[model samples]
Target: MSEAVARHWRSGHVDVEFLPVGAGSYHWRASTPKRPPLFVTVDDLDRKPFLGADADTVYARLRSALETARALRQSGMEFVVAPIEGRDGNVLSRIGRRYALAVYPYLGEPRAFGNALTAEERVALKAMLVRLHAAPKAVASLPRSVPAEVPFRRELELALDSVNTAWEDDQYSRAARPLLAANAAAIRGWLERFDELVRISSADNVDVVITHGEPHSGNIVRSGTHFALVDWDTVGLAPRERDLWLVGGGEPQLCELYRLRWRLDDLSSSVRVLLSPHDPDGDPERALRVLRISIEREPFTRD
Candidate 1:
């Protein structure tokens, strides 16, 4: 038994104890003076994990995130409540078979964004973003994480091919084709002007700040005075613009207003690339190409 593994299974850092949860991730039982027992999750320790990627890579990236969070914690910024590694809340702990452990401050009454954040809360959200992006060296010193950036057109094309040639899910095949056909011109235009789009998207490239790669309203938690960001697992380096993209992309009405909040002067015409049908017979290569394009969109964002 590795010492690290033994320590994690027996008793976790501080008083928090861990329990294993299956699936590419694990969970732990933890408590703090101010909060009661709660569960925190860590990614799986497999050599190759989700989406057919190396598990070690993901593990390392997550560890790096914890380190970054710790450094950020020291800077008087507290948007994210990251898990501390060891007893002293300094070192991150590696846990069971292939998992890691961290303690989350349990919410007495966890408030979801839709319920908690009103129109005013949206202002608070943007303010939190500004503070998060302005963390100076905190995010800079951390690793860069980017989604694969294959051109949206290429991805759609491949996805179309998959629909035609492969045994894919019928629903995805049917829905995506018409969507692509209708949006082909817009999609191709965005692709042809990719660089221009990037430039325009990044006009307010105020800072390449740390961000939660998967930023949906789901990841936010509401506390008394301020909102706390949970799930730092997807933390990575990204253009500050990305912090606002999902909000606008998911909700178009907010596009113009969200841009102003993030201080972006222009909004790049957006396109959602349907890489490949996620069917039983789908080609992974098509998915990979789409992944590459997603990565290319923002060169500096990496994990």
Candidate 2:
């Protein structure tokens, strides 16, 4: 993989040392002479396409993000970390048949927003969201908003089926079976409420904008003295609430400050927690514990 990355970097006439950085994606720190270090990410385009977007869709989204980032920076917002064009003038390069690569100037360590964000950081983040939301629609058009509860309901059904099937014969299910039975009532109630919320939100025609999608603190990096957002993979148009929910988690003051016109009452943070994907190969006992806690502590209620 490093060799492939080196070859790709040579195409741009950039001589740099690639050092493996961290997990999640194939990340590396590229050191170059006469320029700041660059952070490069290479991944299997076939297996891990950007946010499950097809090639054409992924390219269009990246192009739009790059354009928006440049425009935002030119408008005196230096904190926007846009992708740099390769020697071929493309923001993303197709490597072989299975791989795609993108490069950005290395930003410093990401800020950890543990538990809650500080008042000053919240103000800075709010300012950034205002600028992003106000930017002109750079992408041709945004993707249609799918109801969040659709997948949640599907997964809940699958989980219920799995638990039922396991109870029939699997020894591993012994630990989780009782827990599942205990929470069966609560799970069903949450599912019904989730379905209703989805129906209500889906029926409303809401305004959309180019959102950072997942703009939590982990994605916000502090480079030099300023903060810039990374991971444009999820960049697309959706209700401002999509991004606002990440920052405020339904906090009224922050949402109002951002001037969000859409209501987030239906989209609780617990929905994501409840519908989190489970690994088939993972430990069943551990998974049961997680599900138990998540369902027990869920904030949803039949009000």
Candidate 3:
């Protein structure tokens, strides 16, 4: 935990202690006087092997993530726990070199909202999505540090690039490549049909909110009947569907409810098969696709 804090910022500050709160990457619990204690989970950019194709890419991603979250905070999106200057509010902090930390007000351990979430809990999640996808303020420009959403694409792109370089050869080609290829082909078809999807998404009247970029249940905290989202690292401009994609995938009934309530034509099956958490074989194919498409897609959208 201390190591995690050291990754983004200098560990010199007192009163800021990091406790282990979860698994896979840099998850933690932090505390300070200004804000209540809170739990946080972040992708570790400091892992020895590194998260990107090269050290340079990893640095780019980490720096950009910090800058982007800071930018989002400027736009009034507070659902995310960010790492920025000052210990102000419930946001995370960025100190030292790459260490980014935040205090969440300590709402207890993280838990799934579960299958039987009350209407209010569901509404909270949806409302959180609304806040996330709300239009960026006029001056909320994107960071030039790391790849943007279009450049980042989906997560699959990482796998593709790694395999191409043989860095991800052992696990990728043997397990994940084929599934990703099929999904990639499907998404290409979907892109050709993107206009239709966009029309449906628009007509659905659902808020095209900017999102946490990655809003798996793991990033959510539930207390009684209420739920709150954390982790601002992946925040970006996107459809509300981005938030629901994983939620619906986890609960088929919720996906159905989403379809009926929002009138979505079809959610991406590729997103499902590729991003599934329970994918035992590992989602190599989708990873490759994400890296590929990220590079192929334009850098950012023009208003």
Q: Rate the local accuracy (lDDT) of all candidates.
A: 0.49, 0.53, 0.45
Clashes of each: 24, 0, 30
- Give per-residue CA lDDT, model 1, range 115-179, as digits (tens): 33456556666777767777777456785654323323344445434434433445434444554
| Candidate 2: residue 47 Cα off by (Å) | 5.7
Taking the tens digit of each residue's C-alpha lDDT, what string does model 2 give over 2-108? 45444654333454455554323466667655767677877554333333446555455555555556555556667778777666666677666556677778775
TM-scores for all candidates: the values are 0.60, 0.68, 0.47
Single out the weakest 10-residue window by summed lDDT for candidate 3: 261-270
Best by TM-score: 2
RMSD of each: 8.6, 6.5, 10.2
Kindly provide the TM-score of model 3 when superposed on the true structure, using C-alpha atoms: 0.47
lDDT of 1 at 251: 28
| Model 3 spans > 4 angstroms off | 1-23, 30-42, 46-52, 84-105, 112-118, 143-209, 222-226, 244-303
Q: Which ranges of candidate 1 are over 4 A from the true structure?
A: 1-35, 44-52, 88-99, 108-117, 145-156, 162-166, 169-185, 193-195, 199-207, 212-215, 246-303
Among all windows of 10 consecutive residues in model 1, the one with the lowest summed lDDT is 262-271
